[model samples]
Target: MTTAYISRPASAPLVGIGWMVAAGLCFVGMTVLIKSVGAALPAAQTAVLRFALGLPFLLPMLPALARVRLTPSHWKLLSLRAVLHSAGVGLWFFAIARIPLGEVTAINYLNPIWVTVGAALLMGERLPPRRLAAVAAAFIGALVVLRPGLREIDPGHVAMMGTAMLIASGYLVVKRLSEDLPAEVIVAMMSLMVPLGLLPFALPVWQTPGATELILLFAAAGLGTAGHYTMTRAFAAAPLTVTQPVTFLQLVWAVAVGALLFGEPVDPFTLLGGAIIMGAVIFITWREARARRAAIAAAPDALLSRSASGPAARGSSRG
Candidate 1:
């Protein structure tokens, strides 16, 4: 296994936090742009164009992708990631047209809850009592955010939930791939695959965008790509525990931007619910980091103790 990520620096935590904040801002911008574009373009087409315009950003990383050797296993998982990611992008674009931007953005927080459940069930990761509690808390928070009983549920809500689930699945695949592939390779593959996968569905509804919408589209592409790049940097810089909570800032930015730029209303319930989810995610992330640290600290002592006692035990047996 590669050790490229083993000796991460202490400053990584700070850098990761900053990068995650930047990523959140960029994504908030992307969501606003999608709303501005409205429903004139097909959701699939918007998704495809967003990625197509972002393709140039991946050019410098292609050689890094080329250098990495993909195992058959990695390829299979990457394919799965691409499919799930494509679906998520499509549904999220659809939601942008139908839902308030803040609500749409807040709903995607369910991705972490799904990832937690998935890692336990699919990857067989140990889920202790604390993590289980964290999951439950996060789920409750999701309920508050949805408030299904309070208002009529729309197709937009369903689409956003589905997008979250698909994104969670994609995350698991990427986690598996991270063991063997560089982050750059994983990112390059995603940038390349999203447009290619989205194209067939996008083609039928292709429209000639006006100058204003065209500018928004390009800006959207920039935001989306920059968001991913900064997010990758966040992971590279610090442990997930350090950067995970920072993502909640996206919700704040979404609400603010939606209100100021688009005149969307800010709901008190949404803020409360979002805060609950963010708290749960932060707790879960912190617990995971603690577990990892304990494991790492124990490993070397275990090896040393085993080595030190081995020859003595052998000698005593001979006597």
Candidate 2:
């Protein structure tokens, strides 16, 4: 029950929107850097090195991390999360390097859809008929983006699909761990564990990145970490209704970056599908927040404590 989060500012909604936009920008920037790295190094090696290089960023959080005491259950969940996250990182690296950033970002929107289903089934969160419909619409959005029959589906498409599912799986485990642990402890553990989980995969196909690639990947990793922090700030500052839709701005930035810098074509279908998926996610989040508020209102004393168990407590997963 150690609630570790920033106090909400007076102008909480405005501040939350700003933080959400900043988080989206950081994630888009990270995507650009990862794309710039290309296929020079194996995806697994790049992911392993990215986390390894990110170790320095954890230096400032050392004292907080050191104070943590985990139960055996936390260790088991953490290990499972590490495996999911490690695989996700590798697949994401592979997809970003091969696919247009816009499409990649659009397709990645499926993470929330997957999470919705996973949470209902595993976390015992009730998914009503409407929520199930929303989830279905989100999958349709993925179909709109992929349009499988229209074009040959490449390995990149497959990898990105797997990446979203794996990331959702990791998020589910993190939610379980968050039941008892502070957000910082879960992040610190994953920072270490994901690297270890990735090491064996990296060793099999490792190639030394050039110094320039190393620097770029390091910067990307930093942005990824900062993105997570900003996302947490957004959730802490205001309810999901105010911040969730703002994440769509990332699609705009990703598309712009892809075309402007990489000379990639602007894909209209990606944009449309991204909007579809984002709309579904926003609707789902709003419904959850509204329901939680109603429950809190009915029995404030009984449910107020449970409110802390939400995302504001769990923090955002790494990009």
Candidate 3:
């Protein structure tokens, strides 16, 4: 039996971090294009278009997809994850169109915190006091960003909150499916299934996209898909703990994009809040790493469970 993670080559962490940085740049570019498009189309339709346009990228993986023979449980989890992902993507599109780019990216830092809370409350995991405090601190960070009572809460803010929670729930299901399935299969299945899930919602609000809109959407889709690929490569290179911290760098880009592209001012509260939530995420991930190491020590030669969530680690930030 092999370990969950093998010995790394020299500079593996740096290499993994380099890929993570590349992925971040891709995601930032995708977000800029999506925001540039604004709300030209309904969120559901926009989401469907992005995924539908992204279909061709999956073509090369057709053989790998064809070889899969999933049990009923796998189908259930995949379907469930797709549905959650569909909703999350729609909400994300809507939110990004309406909110400041930096704020959108900042709020996204809460995705992992949602998963941590979900595990404890829904999955019966023990959330020791420290983890519990971290969750509380994460929420405080969110409040700082939102500042609900101090100002009128935008519908976009509401949508983004739902986006984080929904996507995190999907990650939970992805975790189950990932155990026996390869990451490629999991990603491909999600790519194919999410559009189908979004179809019903997209139909009512569908508007024919213009040439310029189509070209921009296609570009955004390509970048987003590429980001997912590079993120997966980062995971394959090193553990989540190493790449996870690198994600905070995206906030820097988002802030720059917001200021330089959209004229959105730099909000210090958003920056501080993002940092706080990022710290909580790093803490949670560090703990997860410790737990995995202890488990490996207890059973050194056990078959490694394929962690289903390398890209999911960044969880819809690619949008």
Candidate 4:
């Protein structure tokens, strides 16, 4: 089954670029907020608060959810995704607390690479030679960033890697469910579910946040939700390949934010590694788009051949 994406208005690529830039800003802002509050609360508690507080913004979509007919299988997949997402967010919060914001953000770029591999393994999609090379290059880039043997590997690094993998798995489920469900419904369900899933873990370490922390958390949630919405709009407006490259700006913003706000020195190795990873991801995205277009272009010919053979096969059977 193919997903029917909502039709978007024909907008200029510039408009998509603008939305993408806004999304980068929002994402960076959210990360900054998370880092700022990391010292005050436990990761799981922060994750719970984020989703719980953000639940109100998602309420408007509840009416839309009523329109979606969800099966038992759909509910199961959604529940699994919720659990994975909650875990990913919890890990991310922990990583942010222990690591530089820039490093955490840079490492998170591994999500797309993980998604590509997940597609191959879970969806049985063929991994072409070019994508295989891209995957290798991405890992090499990761090595450059981490320099694992040179420095003692931190728990934060492990957490971020696990976060990427789990999140990627959740995305795979999202892709499958998207074939039948509206994006709004999928997002809303995840938003509602994450808080519930994280509540238990959060309870043990929960502390009442001060007014400033509360305000910051709320703002971060808003930015995160807005970022996702804008990203969706951008994808709808323009091709994924077109907007994909713009995302690298987030890493730049991350570096700047870390340096200015946290007084973390900019690491050249991390920047180089992030650039390499981004390059590979961009190439993979472009290659996939090309392949998809080729498939679509050949589809009509395949259908025409089948149609032409139909009458002959029927006559042979009759004879």
Candidate 5:
């Protein structure tokens, strides 16, 4: 067991950085696609189309699933994650169709904050003072983004908030299951399950998409698939602490695209709020990395002490 633990390859911090880049690109592209669909396409239909087109990329992974084994607990957890992820997708699509692209992207950052809180509450993970403070800072940033008191909050904003919460919860669940399953299996299951779950809702108002719409839909799906694949590779190579900070780049990309592509205005408040959220998130990740390093350093010494106290040592002492 010790040998196996020791043999686990070091996940490079740079890998995490790469994953962040991929994720940023994927999300920015997704937002652009959503904006292109406009209010003409039903959010549900757009979501269904996104997943449907992405299905092909996952086909090759189906065979790998056969080699993989899942425990009952893993199945249950995966099911929960699938549900949460699907709902989050639905909510996000609705929010994007209704809200400004920059605001939507800014609010989306709340997921990391929610994940931190969920980790503490659900996973019973320890949260030091710095993390707690960071969480508070994040919440404040979200409030600024929403600005509920100054403006009548749109239902889409609420939906986006819900989306963030659901995705964050799903992430914590994925982290719980990461030790047992390969990333591909998890990604494949999500891609497959999203369309399956959306089918019922999609059938109600199924509109035949235009040729241009179809092309955009396919492109969105392809980007999403590729983005996730790159993200997985980065994560596999690096630690979350290294990747978490780079996700901010996505916000920048989204803001630029929103302005240039969609004629969306960049609000100063959004920038300020986003900065607060990013700062808190960075601090939280840094603290966690430091704690992880300390733990790893202490682990070997603890193991050696235990081994030195084995029964053979008592026999030698008696002799």
Candidate 6:
């Protein structure tokens, strides 16, 4: 089967950038809410509530969900992905509650590195030399940020790293599913599945949240949902290379928010490490885009050659 990778129109890059910026802002807002409300809520409970709150927004997609065709294999994959995602979110909530918001966000940038490794090992995708170098550089940057020997490593840091690994695994599953399923169907299933996965974990530690905490959690749910939707739209509008760089803005926003709102001082090490990581990710994305473009450019010649051979072979056979 032929695979078509759509290239956006020239004008769409700007629109994608706008959506990415909005997504960054929404993500920062959600992080802030998580940090605030997490003080009074259990991590698992908060995760469950966040997904529960977001479910209403997805209710309209039920008809679309019903139309999706799924096999037992698909359901198994979906369940695995959901479990990974729920665990990741729970760990993230726990990490944010204990660590500085800026540090947590910086650590989360490790996701791309995890994605690179996962794709190579799990998907059997070849990692070009440049991407391999990029991954190495990103890991060095993470080490700089953590400075394991120089500073005391907190459990929160470990949790964030685990979060990155699990989330990256879930993303790989999404990539596989996207080959056969609509993006909406994948998202809708996730919306339903994560909560169900978290319900048992949440029930054990559930405490009645006050009015303010409830509102904050709901607000977080809204921001997180909006961010994901906008980010997806941005990717659809433009190539990954074009939109991925825009996400670096989230680190800046996270640092600023942490400093201003929570009085968490800016750490130069974190900023430098984050910049390095993002730079590597951007380079990797650019290389991938170039490779795809080359492939797309050559496809027409390939098709023409095949067509030319077909007619000549038929004539020879007839003669």
Evaluate all candidate structures by whole-model CA lDDT and list the values in order. Answer: 0.86, 0.90, 0.89, 0.90, 0.84, 0.89
Question: Where does candidate 5 stray beyond 4 Å?
Answer: 1-19, 69-72, 236-238, 308-319
> Each candidate's TM vs. the true structure?
0.91, 0.90, 0.89, 0.93, 0.89, 0.94
lDDT per residue, candidate 3, 27-81, as tens digits?
Answer: 9999998888888988888888888888898888888889989999889889999
Error of 2 at 196 (Å): 1.2
As a TM-score, model 5 comes out at 0.89
RMSD of each: 3.3, 9.4, 10.6, 3.5, 3.1, 3.0
TM accuracy, model 6: 0.94
The prediction achieving the highest TM-score against the true structure is: 6
lDDT of 5: 0.84
Worst 10 residues of 5 by lDDT: 1-10
The superposed Cα distance between candidate 3 and the true structure at residue 262, in angstroms, equals 0.9
Question: What C-alpha lDDT, on a 0 to 100 scale, does residue 154 get in candidate 5?
Answer: 89
Candidate 6 regions off by >4 Å? 1-10, 313-319
Higher-ranked by lDDT: 2 or 3: 2
In candidate 1, what are the lDDT values of residues 1-319, reduced to their tens digit?
3223466466578889999999998988888888899887889988887777777778889899878888888878888899999999999999999988878877888888899999999989888888898888887887787898889888988999899999999999999888888888988898788888888888888887677776788899889888988998899888898889888888888888888987889987777888888888889888878888899889877977998899999999999
Tens-digit per-residue lDDT, 195-258, candidate 2: 8998998898988679999999899999999999999999888888999999999999999999
lDDT of predicted model 1: 0.86
Worst 10 residues of 3 by lDDT: 300-309
Which digits, one per residue and each the tens of the lDDT, describe model 4 over residues 1-319?
3435566577578888989999999999999998899779889988888877788888879988989889999999999999999999999999998887777877899999999999999889999898999999998988888899998888998999899899999999999999989888999999889989999998988898898888888999999999998998898788888899999999999999999999988988889989988999999999989999999879877977898899999999999
lDDT of 6 by residue, 1-319 (tens): 5666677466499899999999999999999998999669899998888888888888778888999889998998899999999999999999999888877888898887898899999889999788999999998888888899999999999999899999999999999988888877898999899989989998988899888888998999899989988998898788888899898889988989999999888898988888888988898889888999899889988997898899999999999
